[model samples]
Target: MPNLIAATYAPLQSNGTLQLNGIEYYTKYLTHNRIKGVFVNGSTGDFVSLSIQERKELLTAWHQNKPNGFQIINHVGHTSLPLAQELAAHSIGKADAISALAPYYYPITNNNLLIQYCKSIAEAAPELPFYYYHIPVLSKIQIDIVAFMKRAKTEIPNFAGLKFTENNLMGFTHCLHNSTDNQNIMFGVDEMFLPSLGSGAHSWVGSTYNQIAPLYQAIANSFTVGQHQKAASLQQKAIRFVEILVAYGSFLGVAKGLLDYLGLPLGPSRFPHTNLTTNVYSKIMRTLENEGIAPYLGNLP
Candidate 1:
């Protein structure tokens, strides 16, 4: 079975305060949906908008509340290398694994500096496995991916794999093919989940999995059974599901609003990511129902 990890959101009150109280319900919701685990404090979590203290508090809350056997991947990436290392160290015993994207502001294109940044963090949390987040679009830290993966495995003692978020399937495939180690390459693209199957990706991470795992799970099942037409149909539905959320404003905020409708009520998002009104949520529901995508969203209590 393919592994699906939800890149979780930072639940906040309408006043924008941390909704740590919601962690239990969040855990139940994901587990009820059969999600394998969570990738916390990533892009979806609005990590940049959160303070270091808030991020630390979130990591602790998640670890304390996580269901047994569920992996907690803590994203420790920051523009400051020292702070990134501090987060990595802070995650000791709290995180099942630690991950970090490249420093975005004044991003480094040099593969050596990139590896060094990861190495410093990995060293700080020598006990936990480290994953390099490869979302160049956000990090602006593009290099020869195949080469970076090779060097990361060689250089970092605790290097596990990558959260391969980019669409460079050729590089992704090559890295997968040439690897003989235990290092993983968990794919992070939602639309390419089916295509990643072709590249031997057994693990995937995304936010849409929060609301529509069944739709994607159905896609995986269909493909496994040679049901190409049905699989494509479901994948298209998954894409449209995302499109509908995006059609509102910020996909993250609107998605959190969907969680509210589904019964979790995780609360509002921070600025620049606009949360929807109650009326707008009704409109989204109608649109989803009209598109036949409503049934796949499991209700959470």
Candidate 2:
């Protein structure tokens, strides 16, 4: 498991077509900054807004340009089980691992159905490790992950672990400590990452890691050296980064805009997610600088 896996954005052109040519730059930027992997076609990538072919293109682009030592975990979740399976089958040789969110439209409240849904997808790409993307906030299926893990262990042979995205540290802790197998449970809440570290999490996957790998690395280093206050302060800075972006518009949308500063022009976000104008982009940069976060942004291209 990678220490920091960035949930990447889906690059688009002005006309909303896939801007896959930019993946080389994106891959290099993350590698140079020491990011370990990418969680593609996930929420940060605006997967819901993208079509099946578009999603496959994003995964193909990332896989093609993947740097050495960097992993790509493709999220193949869809409301349609058949579509999800199609995606899973497509990712066989392309992705290092595959994950899927619970079906959101009808919502599977029963753990059995959830496991079955996962089982079907896992079977589609029997060669790849499968992770259940447990983001209850979006999926609205608040099933206990610990229970899900127990059932999945018996049923789903290729179940790798979870992309645990909820803020329930208690639940996350239970999943980590009480699992029958050694699960690779990567923490997903970016704002509360410090506490997750304290709870003994080594790996994390989040949108913020795309831009601030150095900052999170600093926090990890500080914690390792017992610099408690320093680590906490750095965590607060991360929280503020999300806060500042959300103030302008959708944090994810604004984050896609920020990637331009690193030299990968990902173009604007899709509908309902705010896209920054040139003036707004400059203003945000100035704000980040004023807020003392510029230095922690790592080496920008």
Candidate 3:
């Protein structure tokens, strides 16, 4: 099966503290939904807002509770090289793989710095495969991903793949074309999953996979079996899901609210991400129901 890894949320209490006890439930939720893996401490997890200690705890909790064969890719990107390396080192045995992003605050002006940044982190966990998290919109270090990746294959031994969240299909295709036999280039745009499938992409990671994995899985299956029309319709439905959440202001904030409404209880978003009011969740559900998206959602509690 093509990998559908969820870029998981950081479950927190109403008071904004880590809900450490919820990891077990979270694991079963992903497994039950047919997801192949979890990408913890990534953009969806609000890694920048979390403390290093809290990230360690999240990693530990997921690693300890993960069922057999459930892959865990830990994101250890940070502004500080030492801290990023420390987190990467920490993931040596706890994570099935490790990924890192460039230092965003001091945006890398050159590809050399970016590759070196990733190279240093990869060195810390020689045992596990390393992926470069190429989320340029957030990282703002928009170097040529293809060129960097080519050099990285030679420069970083354990370099395994990339999590491409940018909207550049051209670059993604080139990266795909240039990928080594041992490497994977995981597409990160959930709404564009069908197009990715058409482009020969078999690996994906995203937040929507948490709620609508079954929907995407169907999309993949349809696309595979000469069901292009059916795949396109399902892709539209998946896009509608994102459109509805975006209509209500911050998508991240209302996203967790939707999870709560469905009984997953991911709790509120951290500061700046903006969680929707409980009163508004029902309206969101109504919108989803009216759009015929509720039918395709993965099983609810």
Candidate 4:
């Protein structure tokens, strides 16, 4: 079975304080939905907006509260190499694996420099598996994954794979097919996951999995049974759901708001990401129910 790893949100209080209390419920919510693992401190967690201390605290809370058998892949990527190394070292024993994105401020256009950046972090957490988070749209360092894997093989001993977040399936496929080590290249685009599955992708990491695990799970089941039509229909619904929510406001904030309906109030999104007001959430919920997408959501407790 493919791994469903949720790129979790950083829970916050109304005043925008870190609400570690929410991790307990967050764990239960994901487990109930059959999510196998978590990708914390990534895009969904608003990592760029958070302080190092808050990120560490979030990691500590997740480490403390994560259910047995649940995997935690803490994202330790930072613009500062030293900070990234520090965060990686901090996850030594707590995280099941650690991942870092390419440096974005002064993007590493060269694959060799990217390898060096990853090497530094991987060495910091020598005991943990390391993944390079390859989201070029965000990092602006659109290097070839196959080349990165080739270099990583000889350079970084702890390199496990990539949190493959780009939409370039051709490159993604090459990484999967040509990798000498058979690394864990997790697909990251939530809306186009079915195509990735068609390409033999067995693991996925995305924010939508946090809310719509059952919908995607059903899609996977349909595909497994050779029900292509059913799977495609469900995939359309998944796509439509993203469209509807993204239309409301900041996609991340709107998604975080939906968590409240799932019985976990994750609070408002941080700066630059608009948090949905209660009225807005109510209207969105009503629209979802009207559109027949509410049944795919987690049950309200």
Candidate 2, residues 193-263, lDDT tens digits: the string is 98998887878999998888899999888988999999999988899889888999988888888887446
lDDT for every model?
Answer: 0.89, 0.89, 0.90, 0.89
Model 4, 1-301: lDDT tens per residue?
5589999999999899999998998888888888999999999999999999999999999999988999999999999999999999999878999999988999898888999899999999999999999998999997767888988988999889989998878888888886555479999999888998998788999999888888899889999999999999989888988998999888998898888755787888898887776788788888778876778886433
Alpha-carbon deviation at 267 in model 3, angstroms = 1.2
Q: Which of 3 and 4 is the better model by lDDT?
A: 3
Candidate 4 Cα misplacement greater than 4 A, ranges: 180-182
Give the per-residue lDDT digits (tens) of candidate 3, residues 1-301: 5689999999999899999898888888888888899999999999999999999999999999999999999999999999999999999889999999889998898889888898999999999999999998999987888889989999999999899998888888999999988999999998889889878898999999988888998898898899999999999999999999998877777787788778887888898886777778788888888988888777853
* Tens digits of lDDT, candidate 1, 150-209: 898889999998898998788889878756568888889898888888778888989898
Per-model TM values vs. the true structure: 0.98, 0.97, 0.98, 0.97
Cα TM-score of candidate 1? 0.98
| Clashes within 3 Å, all models in order | 0, 0, 0, 0
Q: For model 3, what is the alpha-carbon lDDT of residue 301?
A: 36
Model 4, residue 218: C-alpha shift (Å): 0.5
Candidate 2: list runs displaced more than 4 Å: 180-182
**TM-score computed on alpha carbons, candidate 2:** 0.97
Error of 4 at 39 (Å): 0.5
Clashes of 2: 0
